[model samples]
Target: MSSARPDIVVAIDGPSGSGKSSTSRGVASRLGLRYLDTGAQFRAVTHWMLSHDVDLADPDAIAARAAEPQLQSGTDPLQPTITVDGEDVSVAIRGEAVTAAVSPVSAVPEVRARLLDLQRRIIGDGGIVVEGRDIGSVVAPDADVKVYLTADAAARAARRAAEEGGSDLAATQASLASRDQIDSGRATAPLVLADGAVHLDSTYLSLDEVIDKIVSLVP
Candidate 1:
């Protein structure tokens, strides 16, 4: 018998400030597909752990309760939303505090284990653009299309600073570098160019250009 039609999971992985979110959203919206910002899910969970007074340094403690928060991700690419325990945290999760805390929170094997199923569930019947640091490699290895978005450190920093309406460029670059180091070094599902995933560098490309490139890959 012929194998099942592969789910159209457009997995886009990238380091922080690499235009993964924008490209994924644009591609999803243009194609009328669901959008899943897996990174935002991680942020929401990390924010929950912080609010609950969980020790950020204690991986075991964090892991033991990783499933406590109810994370809900809105799939509309036009307006993807993330909430924890029914609380809207789309803005809260983007703050520097959450930014700094998310890397470690995500590094916990238990946390990944908990979110993995939820992510897959959200992608059910899978016609979606899922963006994260490891989506292609772990979350949906058989995704019909996979792209690893990236850019130079300077370019990535500038993009992030622009998003923040002008932050210190140096600081933003430093933070991105730090986050990249942590993410790449993490033992569980480290950021990587998934096997067979096409690498797209958005450093010099407009968002539309990058989105079109990904869309063209959708066969």
Candidate 2:
């Protein structure tokens, strides 16, 4: 938090593997603020859908069932948790299958609508760091610090692969590309840098360096 700024809201938006999650959590933890990972919200919904055998390819089906899951997000930067229907799903939501379906489930207007309300409520009065594809562009456009983080596809894939226990780099790259296409091409609240947002290319930056630079931007 800056001396001149009170109840600061930090919005970090970017494509997968862009380091948005790590950066947001780091910044929030250092600043002693709450943190929210909105992508987890989408993943939680996708996990619920998969568990229920929802037809993910159909938008109408997704929209109709979007509100059925009771999504809860814990704001602890040290131990962020996402649960649905009282079940802790922090790890389950990160599975490859949930990753594959999250984009479509997130694109549904009704699903976004449902999560947007929850997002706003969680971010109320703004002492929080929020990270997701659309957080800067839609969820927290007026945030005190809006950062749109990006990296070259190769770097992004490498980071993701490393995080996923040294998975195949080529396959990870392709998956990231596919996710970028779906997330950016969607008609509603597409992934984008919000107006006045600071764009940081983290392709060569260390996570702490990114966090340091953003923390410096506060005042």
Winner by TM-score: 2
* lDDT (Cα, tens digit) per residue for candidate 2, span 72-117: 9999999999899999999998888998899999899999999999
lDDT of each prediction vs. the true structure? 0.90, 0.92
lDDT of 1 by residue, 75-158 (tens): 998888888989999999998889989999999999999999999898888888899998999999999999999999999999
Which residue runs does candidate 1 get wrong by more than 4 Å?
1-6
Query: What lDDT would candidate 2 get against the real structure?
Result: 0.92
TM-scores for all predictions: 0.96, 0.97
lDDT of 1: 0.90
Task: Give residue 156's lDDT in candidate 1 (0 to 100).
Answer: 96
TM-score (C-alpha, index-matched) for candidate 1: 0.96
